[model samples]
Target: MDTILNLGLNDQTVQVLAEATGNERFALDCYRRFIQMYGDIVLNVEFNKFEDALERNKRRFRVEYDHELQPEHLKKIIDEYKEIIKSSTGSEFPQEPMEQLRKAVMAVFESWNNPRAQVYRRVNKIPDDLGTGVNIQTMVFGNTGDNSGTGVAFTRDPATGENVIFGEYLINAQGEDVVAGIRTPLPISKLQEEMPEAYDQFQKTCTLLEKHYRDLQDIEFTIEQGKLYLLQTRSGKRTAAAAVKIAVDMVKESLISKEEAILRVDPDQLNQVLHKRLDTKVKFNVLAKGLPASPGAASGYVVFDANEAERCGQNGDKVILVRMETTPDDIHGLVMAQGVLTSRGGMTSHAAVVARGMGKPCVCGCEALNIDYKAKKMTVGDSEIKQGDLITMDGGTGQVILGKVPVISPEMSEELQLLLQWSDEIRRLGVFTNADAPADAKRAREFGA
Candidate 1:
C-alpha cells in the first residue's frame, strides 16, 4: 500500500494549519514530510537526497530523531527541501493542491507496475493483470506534537504466535516513519506510559477487532491531539510457526472450530517451521552480531543492492541482501535473498517484518559492520568482506559468521505436530508416497504417509 500523508499542505495552507492548530512546529513538520514523500513518489526525486538534507539539519541542530527538531530547524529543512525538489525535478514543489492530488493519485495507480509490486505479485502468484486502487481521504496529522503518534500492531505476536499485543510506534511521527525503518520505534507497551488514554482506547479496539474478525488482526492507528483513530484493520500476517500456534490456540479458546483452524494454516508455510538451524557443535568465526529479528539459519554470498540481489538470484546464486535498511521498494530483493542483514533499523523494521512474513532469516541493527555500497565491501575494524564473500547468518542468534557454517534440520514444534494431527483427522483424502529406498519409506511412514 502506497501512502502519501499531509496531502493538502502547500505554502498557503501550511500557515493556515499553523494558525488553526496554534502549533507552527507541527505544521512545518507536515510540510517537510509532504515534500519528502511528494518529491520521492510523485516528482521522482531521489529519497536519499531529502534524507541527506534532513541528516544535515539533524547534525546542525544536534538532534537524533526528526521529532527532536524545533520549528525554526524544520523551517530551514522545508526551504532546503523545496530547493532540492527544484534542483532535481527542474520545477518547484507543486503549490497547487488539486494538481498535487491528481498527480498523487496517478502515482499510486502507476505504482501497481513498479518493480517491487511486480516482484511481490510474482512471488505470491498474483496475476499480473490485476491492478491497484487509490483511496483519497482527509489527512490527519500524527506529527502534531508529543500527544500525537502513529503505529502498526498485531493482536497476537506475528513472530512467536504468543497471545499478546505486539507492535511499535513513534511519537510525533507519520505512519511511514514507523514502517520505513528510518527511525527505530518504541514498543507498543510503552504507549501506556506515554499516552494512557490512547493506549487504553487502542487495547479495547484491538479486542473488538479480534473478536469480530475471529482471527488475529493487523491494525494501523493514529493519535492526534491525544484522540485515537483506527486507520485500518485486516488479518495479520504471521510466520508459519505463529500460524499453527494461533490456530491451535483459537480452537482451544472456542473462538474457532478444529476444522476451521486446520483450514487457517497454509500447508506451504509449514516448511518455515521445519527450517534449518546452525549446527551448535561447529566452530565458526563471528564477523559481527546484531538483533535477532527472525528465527532460522542461512548462508549465501553477500550482495549490497536489491537489484543485484535479484539478478544474482535469477542467475542461480544464493545471496544475502545487505542494506543500511530496507523499504517497501526493496520487496524484490527481500524475496530473492536467502537472508537479510542491516546495519541500521530495529526488530520491527520493514526488513525484519517482511522477512518474517516470508519465513526468511534476518539480522538487523548490526552496527559493528560498516557497509560501503559504492566500494562493494563491508568492514569491521581492519577486516574487509568484499561482495560475493561466503557468509553465514543465524537469525535465531543474530550472529554473522565469517564463512559458511553447517546447519541441522529442526524438529517440529509441539503445536505444529498437534495441528498436523488435527489436519490428518479432518482430511478426507488418503495420503500415499512413492519411496525408492527403505530410508525414504521409513521417513514417509513417519510423516503419516
Candidate 2:
C-alpha cells in the first residue's frame, strides 16, 4: 500500500503547493504526479508501468533526478502514465481537477479495506465499519530544493520525555521520505546548522503548539525556501517514563490543572515502568546495538518468523521475534513475543510503534545484524545465531546480547513518586493492590498504593 498522509487544507489549496516554486508550474506538476499515483493506487494500474515510463523519460532527457525533469518532460511522462493507466484499467485518467479530487477522496474511503489497513485495524482493535474520512486541502511541496524539506518533530524527547525538541528531517525530500524510512534523515537539530532561520521559526511554533495544546505535540512541518509551514500537530506519543515526567512537569509548570495531569497518565502504562532492566554493573557480551525503540529487558529463544513466534509463545515458550522489518501482518507475532528485534526500520516504523504501544521491548534498525530468513539464522559480525538460540536484549540501551544476561527489578524514581502522589490525590477511584507478602506490600506502598 502507498504511504498516505492526512493533510488539513483550508481555502488556499492550490496556493500552498505553488507557493514554493511560483505560478501554476509546480501545482500543475503536482497534479500530474497525483494523477499517476491515483491511477496506480485507486485504479489498480501497475505502479511499475508508470515508473518505467518515468524512468524512460528521465533517460531520454538525460536527467539524473526526478526533480530535475523539465515541464515538457513531466507533461510527456504524465501523458504516457495516463495511457498506461487506460490500457491497464480500461478507464480514462480524470483530467478535470474536480474529477481527480473526487476519485482521490473515494480512493481513501476504499483503502480502509486494503489488506494492510485491515490487518492494522484488527490488530489495534479499531472498528472495521468506521470508514476513513477524506480531508482535501492544499498541498505543500517539501522537495522543491535544498531550502525546502519535510520533517516530524516532538515537543519533548519521545524516548525519555526530556524537555527538548526531538525529531528527524531531510532536505529536499517529501514527508514519506522521512516516515517511510526510505532515507536515513538527519537529526532535527541539524536544521539549526543548515537552516538557522527556519529552525528558529520551527522552535517558536513548537513552543506555541505545546502551550496551546497543553501537551507534548508531535508536529509535521515543511520548509519552502526557508519559510516554515506547519502541516499538522497532535499529542505526541512518549514512553512510560516520559509520560510520567511530562505529566508531573506540566502540573508544576501549571500548564494543566492537577486533576488533568493525573488523568493524563494511563494506569496500564505504570506496568511499563516496572519492567525488568539490565544491570549496568554486570558486564556481558553485546552482539549488536540499535535504536532503543522501546524500554525494558527481555530474554527469549529467537524466532525469525512471526507465526513461529506465536506458536512458541502459545506453547508457553518465550520467544523474541526478529525480522528485517515488520508490517501490520506481524502484529500477531509481536503480541506474542517477549521482545522484537528488527534490522531495517526507524524508531517510528511499524515494529517500533506497535512494540511501544504494547509495552514490549524492541530494538530496531540494527544494521549490524544480517538476517537470512530462509536459513532461519542471523549473523552479527563473526557470531551466527540460529533459530531457538537463547538471546537477551536491553531495549533501554538498544543492546542485543548473545545470551541471557543478569537483570534487576526496576525501581520507581522520584518523578514517578510525585506523579503517582498527584494522581492519588485527584483520581476518584481508590488504588489497591493484591500484594500478599510484606516486601510486595512495601513496594506497593512506596508506589502510593
Candidate 3:
C-alpha cells in the first residue's frame, strides 16, 4: 500500500472548477496526478515505466521536474503526463473523479505497508494496520495570482514554546512545494511585509484554531484571490520548553485547568528540554542566516551542510550542520550533528519539526548570518568566521554566538510545582517528569505545591 493524496473531483466538481477558472487545464491536471497516483498505488503499475516516461516528458518540455517548475509549466507537464499515463496503462486517466477518489483512498491506506512507511512505523512503534485517514478536500488554488499563496503555520512557537505564530509561506505557490523545499520558502514575516491584509486574516485564523481546539494547532491553508481556505488543522506537537510554557500560560489565560496543562507536556519531550544547550551571550563572527525552524544551542567544527555533517560525524568529529534550508534529505546531517543552522524556512518548516523530534539543537531563520561553504567561513555584514573556527548557535534565543559558552541548566520553576500537583491530583497518576540529569528532576520537584 502507498500513501496517496486523493483528488476527490467528481463530474460536478470538475465542471464547477472548469467553469470557475474558464480553463479545463487546472482540473485536468489534478485529475491526471490523481490517476497516476492511483494506478501506481492500487494497480501496482510498474513505477519505472512511469518514471522513465516522466523523465522523457520533462526533457521534452525542457523544464525541471517538480523542483521550481512554474504552475504554468506544471500544467503543461500535466497534459503531457496524461498522455504518458494513457500510453503506459492503455486507459485514459480516470475522468470519474469519485472513482478516482476511492482508489486514491485505498492507495493511501495501502501506503502503510510501503517499506519507508513501515520503517517509520517500526521506529515510532506505530501499528502497521492502523491507517491514515484520507482527506478528500476541495482544491483551493494558491497559485491564482499575486493575491494567492500557501503556508503551514503553528498557533505558537513549537521550538521555544512562545505564543507567536510560527510558519513559512510561498507566495503564488501551492501545498507540496512549500514542503518539498523546491524553492526557498519565505518567512511568515515576509507576508506581513508583502501581503499585510492576508497576514492579518491569517493570524485571526490561527487564534480561532487555538481557541477552539484548546491546544496548539498546526494549520495548512491557502489564499486564493485574496480569500483563505483552511485545508487541514491538527493539534500541534511542541518542544519541551514551549510545551511547558504554553501549558502554564494557557492556565494563566484561563484556557485550561492546571491539571490539563501539566498533562500537555510529554515526558519524552521534557527530556529534550532538559538537555544542556549552547549559551547565547558569546559573540559570533556570523555566517549565512536561514529560517530559525528549531531551537537549542550547540557548537562544533563547521561542516558545510548535512552531508559533511554526517560524514564528519561518522568519522567521529563533532560537527555543526549548516544549510540554506534543510529538507527531508538533511535528516542524516541532523542525526550526526552537534547542532544545525539554516538560512531559509520558518519555525514550522520540516527541518525544525524533525530536529525537535530528534531532540537536536537547531537555529533557523537567521537572515543576518551567511556561510560561504566553499571558503569554509561564515560571515555577518562585517565579520567572518572560518568553518573550523568554532561557533555556537542559541536555539532558545535565536542567536549564533562565537565559541561555546557556559551552559546553566536551571532547576524547574515554582509554577511547575503547582501545575504538576494539579495534574497528579486530577489524573491520579504519579506524574513524574522524565529527567536525564539530576538538575531536571530538582527543577521538576521545585514546582511542587
Candidate 4:
C-alpha cells in the first residue's frame, strides 16, 4: 500500500496510442495532469504557488464548475490548463508519458497526509500511517462528446439501505467532476431517459461490480464514446435507515446470514436516531436559549431546575428542560423534559452523546447563555429571559429557531424496505440502523435492516 509506481508510455508509445485514440489533445491533457500531481509530491513544488497558477489559468479560460460543456469547450479547458502550467512554471507540462506516470504514483502516496485527507482519515477512523498505493492503468476520458459521460454508483442505497443501485451522473464530464456535487447533478435515473443503452450498460455493470466486490461497492466509472471504464471502487457508507433495510433485503437474497445481518449495523448510530423529536410543523412560543444536549424539537413550559422539571412532568405539564449542564442526578428531569438543553459540553461530551443515543433534540455548547436557577431566568448575552418561555431547536442542522417553522415525518415506503432486504441478502451481514427516538427507531425497523 505504500509503494509508488511510475506509469504510462514513452514518446514513441504515446505517439502510437495517440494514433489509436485519434486525439492528441486528450493524450497530452492526461500527460500534464499526471505531471502536475506527481511533480508536486515527488519534486516538492510549492502548493500555494501551484494553486495560484492554476487559478490564473482557470480565470484565463473563463471555465466554471458548470458541466454543460460542448466538445470544443472541454478541449479548450484542458489545452489551456496545460498552457497555464507551461507559462507559469516556465516549462512544458511534462510530455514524456513515463514522467506523467511516475508523478501520479508519487502523488497518490502523498495524498495520505493532505490536510483534507488527514481530516477525512480522522473522521472515518482510518489510520494516519497507512500510505496509499497509486494505481495507474490507462487514461479514460468521459468528456469525449455525445457518447461519453461519467457517474458514481453504490450497489445498495446509502440513505435507506435500499437494494437498488443508487447514484448520480453527468454526461460529458470526468468521473470526479460529477461527484463533487458542485452544481446540481442529474439523477442516475436520468440516463434511462437520456441514453437507454448507456443506462442498461451501467445497470449491468453495477451488478457485476457488486458481486465481484462482495460488498456494498461504490464505483467511479466513465463511458468514453459508449465503452465503460471503471476508474475506482470501494465500500460505501450509508445512513442508519439504509443500513437496516439493506441488511434484511440482502438476507432474502441469501447474500448474508442471520448473525451477519445483526453485525452490519453500528449500534451507536441506531441509538442516535431514536431521540424524541418535536414536530417540526408545530408552533412554539419564544423564550430562553441554551444548549441542546440531545436533538428533538420541544415546546413546553420552561422548568428552570431539574427538580422543577421533574415536578412539572409529574403534573402532566410538557416541560422545556433548561440546564447549564446535566449531572447524573438530573437524568429524571432529562427524561421528563420535552427536550434537554446544555450550556456546555462538546459533541463527545456526556450530554451530546446521550442526546444522540436518546434520539432527542439537543443544542449543546451554546456558550453565550448563563443560567440563573434561583432567579428563574437565564442570561443569553445581553438579553435576560425568564421561566415559562418557549423555544425550539433543530438537532439535524444545529439550528435553533424562535418558533416552529414546518415539520415533516419521514416514513419508509414498502419499496425501501424491500430494497434493503435485497442488500442484506447480498452482503450476508446484518444491517441495523442507528436510531434513538421512537420515530427514528421505528423508521429503521420499518426498513427491516
Candidate 5:
C-alpha cells in the first residue's frame, strides 16, 4: 500500500507550517519525510537514494536516529531528496496540493493490482473482482516531538490469544517507523511511562472497541501533542492456534455462543493447529538458533531471494527463504515459501508477523548466520551452505538444522478439540469415511467423521 504522510508540504507551506507549529525542527522533519515517501511511492525514485542521504546526514551530524537530526540537517536531506526525485523522474517535485493528492490517490488505486496484492488475494482465495477502496483523512503528526508517537496494538495477543494489549510503539516517529523495522520499537507497555494519559485513554478505547466489535481488533493510533487519535481498526489477523483459542475463550466468556465460536474458526486452519514438529529421537545437526517467531517445523531446500523462492515454489519445490530481514514487499515470496529464516529483525518484524498470519514456520534474528545474498550462500562458523541445500527449521524452538530430519505430527490442543466438538454438535450434515481399513476408519472416527 502507498502511504504518503505529510503531504501538501512544499517550500511555501513548510514555512507556514513551521510558523504555525512554532517548531522549525519538527516542520523540517515532516517536510523531509514527505519528500522521501512521496518521491519513492509516487514519483518512482529509488527509496535507498533517500535513505543513503539521510544516513549520511546522520553520520555528519554525529546522531544515531532520524529524530535526533536538527532542522539544518533535515533541510539538507530534503534538498538532496528533491534533487534525487528530479533527476530520477526528469521533473521537479510536485508543489501543488491538488497535484500531490491526485498522484498519491492514483498510486494507491494502482496498488490494487500490484504483484504483492495479487499474490495475497490468490493465496487467501479472496475474489480478485472485489478490488480496493481508498480513504483520505486529515494528517496528524506523530513525529511532532517527544510528546507524540504512533503505535499498532491488538486487543488480545495475536500469537497466543491472551486477553491483553499487545503492541509496539516508537516515540517521535511516524506510523511507518514502527512497522518498517528500521528502528527497534519499544513495547506498548512502555507507553504508560512515556505518556500516562494517552496510554490510559488508549487502554479504555481498546476495551470498548473489543466489546463493540466482539473480536480481536488491530488498532492503529497516534498521540500528537499528548492527545490520542485513532487512525484505523480492523479484525486482527492471528495464527491458527490463536484463532481456535480466541473463539473458545470468547464463548466461555459469554461474549459469543458455541455455534458462533465453531463458525469463527476456519476449517482449513485446523491443519496448522495440528502442526508438525521435529522428531525428538532424531539426531540433528544444529546450525544456529534465533527467536521462535511462529510455531511449526518445516524442512526444505533453501533459497536466498524472494524471487527465487517464488519461482522454485511454483515449480513444486518446497523452499525456505533466507534473508537479512523481510519487508512488506516480500509478501509474494513469503506466501510461496514453506518457512523463513532471517538474520535480523525481532519477533514483531515484518517477516515474523506475516509468517504467523499465514501459519508458516519462521525463525528471526539468527545473527550467527552470515547471509551473502549476492552469492546465494549463508555461512555459520566454518560451515557454508549454498542455495538449494536441504535444511530443516523448528519455529517452535528457533533451531535451524543442517539437513532434513524426521518430523512428528502434534496432537490438537484442548481448545481445538472443544471447537471441533462444538462444530460437530451444530453441524447438520453427516460425515462418512472413505477409509478402506479398520485402523483408517477408527482414525477418521476419532477426527469426528
Candidate 6:
C-alpha cells in the first residue's frame, strides 16, 4: 500500500494487484489513494484537507472503520479529495489517469532537490544528480482484518548480533504504524503465539532469504487474511561487534568462504570494537533501556544542542549529544560527541546509522526519556537530568545509568583471531607488513606475521 501510494504504479503493478485480489476495485482504490497521497506529499496540498474530507465521509456514512465505508462513499471521498487539491493549488486535478501518473513521476524527480533529500545526499556522499529509482510494486493490505498484520524482522538480533530472529509487528495495521512510532508494537515472538502457522512460514522464509542472499536479511512482510506476502528484503545492518561475530559464524557454518567473510566485515567498523565497554559483572543504577543502535560505552555530561556539544568538545570536555531526533545537520555535533542518545528513532534511523558509521556509542528510540530542548533537560519517570549533568550509557546493552560508571577497554576475542587466521589461509596473497619500530615488530609477531 505504501509503495503504490508513494511511487505510483505501472500496468505491470496494476495487473499483479488485480490478479492477487481478484478485484478490479482494489486497483481503482489504489489509484485513488495514490492521487490523494501524492498530492499531499509532493504537490504541497495540505494533508488536513484530505483528512477532514475522510472524517466527514466516515461520519456521514456512520462508519467507524475506513474500510467499512461503502464503495460509493469511497468514490465520494476521491472526488472531494481532488476538489481539495484543486482549490489549494489553484489548478484542476488531472482528469486522465495517465496524466496523474505522469505528474506523480515528475513529483518524485522534484523530490531529489528538496532540502531533506539534499542534506541526506550531501551527508552520505551520494551523488546529487544521480537521481533516485522508483519501484512500483503491487500493494498488500495488512489492515485487511484480525488475521492481517505487518512487520519488520532481522535474520539476526540487531542489538546483540545473536543469530536469532529479531523484529516487531502490529496486528491489523499498515507498515507505517510500526516504524512511525504511532503505537508500541508487539515483539515478533508474540506472533508465534497469536498466529503459529504464519509464524512458522515466516521463520522458513527468513532462513531462505538469508541463505539466498548469503547475508543476514532485514525483511518486511505482510499477512493478508492469513496469507503471508514478502514486501522487501535487504542486507541487515549491525554494530561492529555483531558484524565480527556474524562474519566469523558464517565462515564456520560454511555458508561463505573465509575470503568472502573477511570482505563482509568493514575495516572501518573495527574501530568500534576497540571502544570502552561497561563491565557486565559490575552493578549500577539503571535509568532506562532502548535499542542498542551502536556498541560501546561512555560517561559524559549531557548537552541537548549540537552547537553546544561542539563547543564543549572543543574545550576537551566529554559530552553526550541528546535529541528528540537527529538529522544530517547534526553531523558536526555527532562527530564531536563521545556518545549519542535520542528519545525517538529506531535501529535504522538517522542517528543510529550515523553513529555506527562513525564508530560512536549510541542508544536511540529511548521512548522513556522525555526531552525538553528549551528546558535543557530530560526526564525518566520521576528523575530529571539537567544540562551538564553526568550520566553513563552502554550502547551494547542500551542501558542508561545515572552518574559516572567504570568501564574497561575492549579486548580482541578469540573468535576474531581465528577468523583472521582463516582469512590468511584462504587468500592467495601472503600477509606482509613494514614495521618501523621494535614495538611495531613485536605487535606484528604477536599477530602471527
lDDT of 6 by residue, 64-181 (tens): 7554665577667777877887889888765555665676667766767776566556655799878776665666777656688988888997645689998888787667545544
Candidate number of the best TM-score: 1
Q: Which of candidates 3 and 6 reaches a greater lDDT?
A: 6
Order of models, best lDDT first: 1, 5, 2, 6, 3, 4
- TM-score, predicted candidate 2 vs. hidden true structure: 0.77
Q: Write the per-residue lDDT of candidate 5 for residues 234-326, one digit (tens) a residue.
A: 998888998999999999988899988887888788778877899999888799998787889999999988999989999999999998888
User: Which candidate has the highest lDDT of all?
Assistant: 1
Ranking by TM-score: 1, 5, 2, 6, 3, 4
Cα deviation in Å at residue 222, candidate 4?
Answer: 1.4
Q: Scored by Cα lDDT, where does model 6 land?
A: 0.77
In model 2, which runs have C-alpha deviations exceeding 4 angstroms? 1-100, 114-130, 303-317, 327-333, 373-376, 426-438
| Deviating ranges (above 4 Å) for candidate 3 | 1-103, 119-125, 187-202, 280-284, 299-344, 365-393, 397-449
lDDT of 3 at 36: 56
TM-scores for all predictions: 0.93, 0.77, 0.67, 0.55, 0.90, 0.71
Q: How do the residues 219-283 of candidate 3 rate in per-residue lDDT, one tens digit apiece?
A: 88888878878888988867677778889889988999876787787766656666575434634
Task: Give residue 307's lDDT in candidate 5 (0 to 100).
Answer: 91
Tell me how far the alpha carbon of residue 210 in candidate 5 is from the true structure, in angstroms, after superposition: 1.0
- Please report, as a residue range, the 10-residue window in candidate 6 with the lowest summed lDDT: 1-10
- Candidates 3 and 4: which is better by TM-score? 3
- Candidate 1 structure quality by residue, lDDT tens digits, 83-103: 999998788899999999999
RMSD of each: 2.1, 5.6, 6.7, 14.1, 2.7, 6.7
Q: Is candidate 2 or 3 superior in lDDT? A: 2
Encode model 4's per-residue lDDT on 309-372: one tens digit a residue: 8788888988767666554445566666766666654333334433443445666656566878
TM-score of candidate 1 against the unseen true structure = 0.93
lDDT score of residue 213 within candidate 5:
91
lDDT of each: 0.89, 0.78, 0.68, 0.59, 0.87, 0.77
lDDT of 5 at 136: 91
